[model samples]
Target: MTTAPLVRRAHDRGIAVLTLDSPHNRNALSAALIADLTDALDAAERDEAVRAVLLTHTGSTFCAGADLKADGIGKGPGLLVGLIRRIATLAKPVVAKADGHARAGGLGLLAACDIAVASDAATFAFTESRLGLAPSVISLPVLDRVDPRAAGRYFLTGERFDTAEAVRIGLVTAWDEALDGILAGLRAASPQGLAESKAVATRSLREALDSGAEELVRQSARLFTSAEAAEGMRAFVERRDPSWAL
Candidate 1:
């Protein structure tokens, strides 16, 4: 595990900080990372001392979206759904702490968190449309958090925005500040209090995930399997423009 990129560290303040340490791929949500994150989240939820969960990353980019070049990319949509769901529905409050750029599905992960804070310099984009895919499954949690009008523009344009814009659009809770204070507040609360209050706070989002996830999964599978998406993803890996980028 010494060489593994995913780092799990439990703070004495009862916060489980899960770092997406694989900066080689900009911590792309590969199958392995997804599995590791899901397992870690489950463990945190069950840990008696864990009052909350903090999801963060290393390197300049929080996540570069999916590992477009991964071996099992075909199975990614379902796995992504599960990973996002796990974070959203975890018993404890989940907070996102980012000091880097996040794009595509990475934004989905941010939206699923109960609270998300990012550095003032961080940026974000919903690049799914450019990849010949839609933020279908992620839209479940994302739209729930984001302003409908702002989500419409970003989802369609796939344009990048700054952290201040992210906060304005409701994509993130705030610009990065004293996260220790936030964690301390959680630690001060009874675990059951935090859990139950979070449940109340996220009830609608959880329902949206549960009730709407199936069709979105099918939509994601269909889009990801399409020839258009293949070219887009290939172009992305090639660091070139897709054919449709005229």
Candidate 2:
């Protein structure tokens, strides 16, 4: 018997559709999933007909961050940082289309994209703090895209925010019912123009990640191996509040 892939890919017009299909774990970024996504991106990039990439999900939760059982935050930082950096620096425009919830490192994935379009039903949060972790790796992409004040609030509190709040804070590009217009726009643009524009737009984000990736990965490793993170992750996996929670 063969296992189903965590991610599925399809080509539509000039857009390469990469769907996160692992609903069982809320499409968490496991090693397998990340590898598959990276492979899909490589394939799309090599294809001359592909002008842009559209990232979407198949379940109620777009992504619930790292898979605690598989990744446990310990192994996730390096893998996640590499994947997100690839997205940030990809030559073609990558758009995230979300209609569900994105948490922790999952938020980083979408934020790394050139544009993120969420439906009104979409929700988001920086949930790392609640798990005795910081949004260290994700901060590279997220902080650059969002208002610092708002990032501080969500990053510290782990409070959930909706699409309207997301857009207001610049976390999401827009909250539309569908992505037809965005797809059409990408399809209409010339390939070279899209690549150049994406480069100009993502230059700063790329620089930030390039400069800080090592430190952030170290920070994540430190946090994940600590007693506090251990207890927090235990509580989370067991569906209970950590000892530190008031």
Candidate number of the best TM-score: 2
lDDT of 2 by residue, 1-246 (tens): 998888899989888999999998999999989999999999999999999999999989888888867766566889999898889778898999998999988899989888898987789999889988899999999988999999999999999999999999999998765478888888999989988998899889989988999999999899988999889888987999999999
Q: What alpha-carbon RMSD in Å does predicted model 1 have with respect to the real structure?
A: 1.7
State, as a TM-score between 0 and 1, how close model 1 is to the true structure: 0.94
Residue 18's lDDT in candidate 1: 90
Clashing pairs in 1: none
lDDT of 1 by residue, 17-99 (tens): 89888888888889989888998898898888888999888889988788867744577877888987787778898999889
TM-score, one value per model: 0.94, 0.96
The per-model lDDT (C-alpha) reads 0.86, 0.90
Best by lDDT: 2
Tell how far residue 147 is off in model 1, in angstroms.
0.1
